[model samples]
Target: MVTDKDGYIHLVQYLTEHLGIFENSQQQSVTEDTVMELFEEQLAAQIIMVCGQNPSLTFSQRNLVVREVDSIVYDLEEILARVSGHKATAEQSVFISELSCLIKNLFDQEIARMISL
Candidate 1:
């Protein structure tokens, strides 16, 4: 289920949702740390590393992407805290603000059609 992972970040599509429901029931399911490690190894660095590389979202994939991004936005603060040792700083504050803006624009406000990867 989704590359042998236990948890699932919600996607608008049925594939991700069903995988989550099923894999989560397995005794050998993956853990949160595994997902985090995978993200850190793959997509985590890309968030800032990519920077403003927005492109048009395809109609078929938009919903799935939206759900995944929405989950990221929801959990970003906890992720940041883990990375920053829970120490608040002006830079961190500003970054959080920007992340909030991105979440709002992408999901809540629904402004941007393009997502940078």
Candidate 2:
């Protein structure tokens, strides 16, 4: 249960981190802000649902989850830095597209893991 919760938390952290990267990379536009806000809300709901189900997890377990989240945050920061630009190169665009797909896969896997738990 603890592991399941940890995975979900980590998944959300990854999503938000990427969203932040996207936010920072994009111009200060209303569309970007709206999309980022929506993404944040979606992640927040997932975190709440996962934690609510496994309320008995230990403090250490929770901390472990947070640590994983932090790690992904750092990773996303790097990925964002690489991809952010008004005119991304072909390689940069491919990297961003691949990263986006991988993040989506991770979210799907985490949701399945939570359900199985």
Candidate 3:
């Protein structure tokens, strides 16, 4: 089965291309705050899109999804602050992998809940 981590790779690749999350400093002003904001927006948009597909989702369910996404984004802000300006590729990869796992778990739980109802 294709896991959320696999899907996250695709999602990150899309975000990197469209949002320039890893672009050179001269090419874009990629601050941690900006990256977090963009990421939150993208996550919200994706949630909204999924909710749109499942029109039976109640208001509380939608709110829960928003809350969860907000919590993750908040955590991401902290992670970004810690890792920002660090040039070590291995360290970055480790952080990214862990974050992706966290995100995948969140998505899996939320999507499972959504699917059950």
Give Cα distance to truth, residue 82, candidate 2, Å.
Answer: 4.9
Candidate that scores best on lDDT: 3
State each model's C-alpha RMSD to the native: 14.2, 8.8, 8.6
Could you arrange the candidates by lDDT from highest to lowest?
3, 2, 1
User: Which residue pairs in candidate 1 have backbone atoms (N, alpha carbon, C) closer than 3 angstroms, thus clashing?
Assistant: none
lDDT of 2 at 39: 34
Better of 1 and 3 by lDDT: 3
Compute each candidate's TM-score over C-alphas: 0.28, 0.40, 0.49
Task: Name the lDDT value of residue 99 in candidate 3.
Answer: 50
Which runs in model 1 stand beyond 4 Å of their true positions?
1-70, 73-85, 109-117
- Show the colliding residue pairs in model 3: none
Number of the candidate with higher TM-score, 1 or 2: 2
Q: What are the per-residue Cα lDDT tens digits for candidate 1 across 1-117?
A: 121123232221333233332223233323333333433333433433323333444555455554555466345434433442223333333334443343333342232323333
lDDT of 2: 0.46
Residue 49 lDDT (model 3): 67
* Candidate closer to the true structure by TM-score (higher is better), 1 or 3: 3
